[model samples]
Target: MVRNPGRRAALVDAAVEVLARDGARGLTFRAVDGAAGVPNGTASNYFVSRDDLLAQVAGQIHQRVAPDPEEVAAVMAAPPSRALVVELVEWINRRVAGDRTGYLAMLELRLEATRRPELQKELTRTIRAARDDDLRFHRESGLPGDATAVRLMYLAMTGLMLEQLTLPGVVPAEETQGLISALVDRAIGPEGAA
Candidate 1:
């Protein structure tokens, strides 16, 4: 859709920073313009509309969350130990903390999408694509309760993210390890696990 995709990407990156720093309630066109170091008119011109700008920011967050081939491979290859789960949780926590404004903006976008069909459709597609990737990982593992592990993995990841947001100071690494170990036990039991 963009002739120079790089320019669009720059706007999205800027949007994420602005959204996180300012939060959804504080974000404004002029704010993004300043944060992006672009002319005030530039953001409006490129994004075309307010909703368009919000959607682009939200889309970028989804893109970040969704596992591309590289990420999936990295996660899959990461030893499959409880420590690996802690690492992954740490990774997700960093992504969320890296831009709280952007994350909050995404939450706002999700709420808005609920009332707008087009936005809802894109969000659905993005989430379903992520779910499918998870399913694929379980399928490839060829381990008992692979499906359950995959599901619980997502749930625990989400819960951790929420915890991080709720109490950023307290999500210790040990808690992450415990969560992973518990999930693994529920999914595979001690006997089935390696």
Candidate 2:
């Protein structure tokens, strides 16, 4: 594969756009090249196959949506509680709200994975790693939760995000923080006295 980080990144971003707008079925090398505004076959040069492109897109989605280091540090510095968990959920929700396209592309990747065992394995591995990381962070941050609690929070947030993104009026944007707060409190509990 070509080793031009800048170009490769651009192509991947373009692929994300295409995937979000057109779904996995519409994600093709030519479409990505066109979306990237590069010459024909540029995407193919960067990604050898469809699965390669999809896998890279999976990795890129996490990179694009991850919280900034400073934001993470600030949160981690605070005493852990349901409120802190709510804050984290709100942070992620804000990102999803701001970049609906990227989140949609991620959902598209999930659907595509269902039909491709190779991609499914890759996604399962990556998602497992992320879940494990979340568990570790929860423990280190003194968050009042176990792995199962974390998983439940993840599911709830995912559902909330999907509804908010897919059916905008289904969950009022202004109420999202409150909803997250409620979910987190229900899943964990009130903060310990600081």
Candidate 3:
């Protein structure tokens, strides 16, 4: 396989597009190559197999949607509280909203994982690790609540995103901010902590 980082990244990106538009079953090497506008077999050269492509798509999406360093630094500089938590949630919501395709690809992977035990195990570990990271962040910030709070917040945000992306009008756009604010309030407790 070629060691060209740029090319590999492009293939992964194409895979995400395919996964989002066609779902897991359509995420083949040829499909990625076509979506990437690369030569036939190019995707094969970059990814060892479909699973590798799926994993890379997940990684690329994570990187794409990760908070900006400047944003994180600014937030970190402030004291952690319910308001901070709300801002963070809003920031994440905005990012995910902007990258609907990437998030959709991620959801597709989740469905695909259900039928693939090995993929299911890997994704579960990855998701758990992300939850751990969030829990650590909350703990370090001295935010209110504990790991359960973090987990609940994560669940709320995921559900919100799913609705926002799949059936946007199900919850009016104006109500979303209010709903998230309430979720954060409850998740962090009466003190707005965590």
Top candidate by lDDT: 2
The residue ranges of model 2 lying beyond 4 angstroms of the native Cα positions read 192-194
Question: Per-residue lDDT for 115-142 in model 2, tens only?
Answer: 9998889888888888888888888777
Give the CA lDDT, 0 to 100, for residue 161 in model 3. 88
- lDDT digits (tens) for residues 1-194 of candidate 3: 79999999888888889999999999999999999999999988888888888778766776766778788888778786677778888888888888899899889989998988877888788878877888898898876667887899899889988898889999878998898888877876655232
In order, the Cα lDDT scores of the candidates are 0.67, 0.86, 0.84
Clashing pairs in 1: 19-101, 19-102, 20-100, 20-101, 20-102
Clashing pairs in 3: 143-194, 144-193, 144-194
The sequence of per-residue lDDT tens digits that candidate 1 reaches over residues 1-194 is 33567777877777777766665555577777787787776676677776787778767887665445787577668555545544554566666767555556666666667787887888778777877876775566543456667777677776776666657667775666566666656755654355
List the candidates' TM-scores in order. 0.75, 0.92, 0.91
RMSD for each of the candidates: 3.5, 1.9, 1.9
Clash totals in order:
5, 0, 3
lDDT of 2 at 13: 98
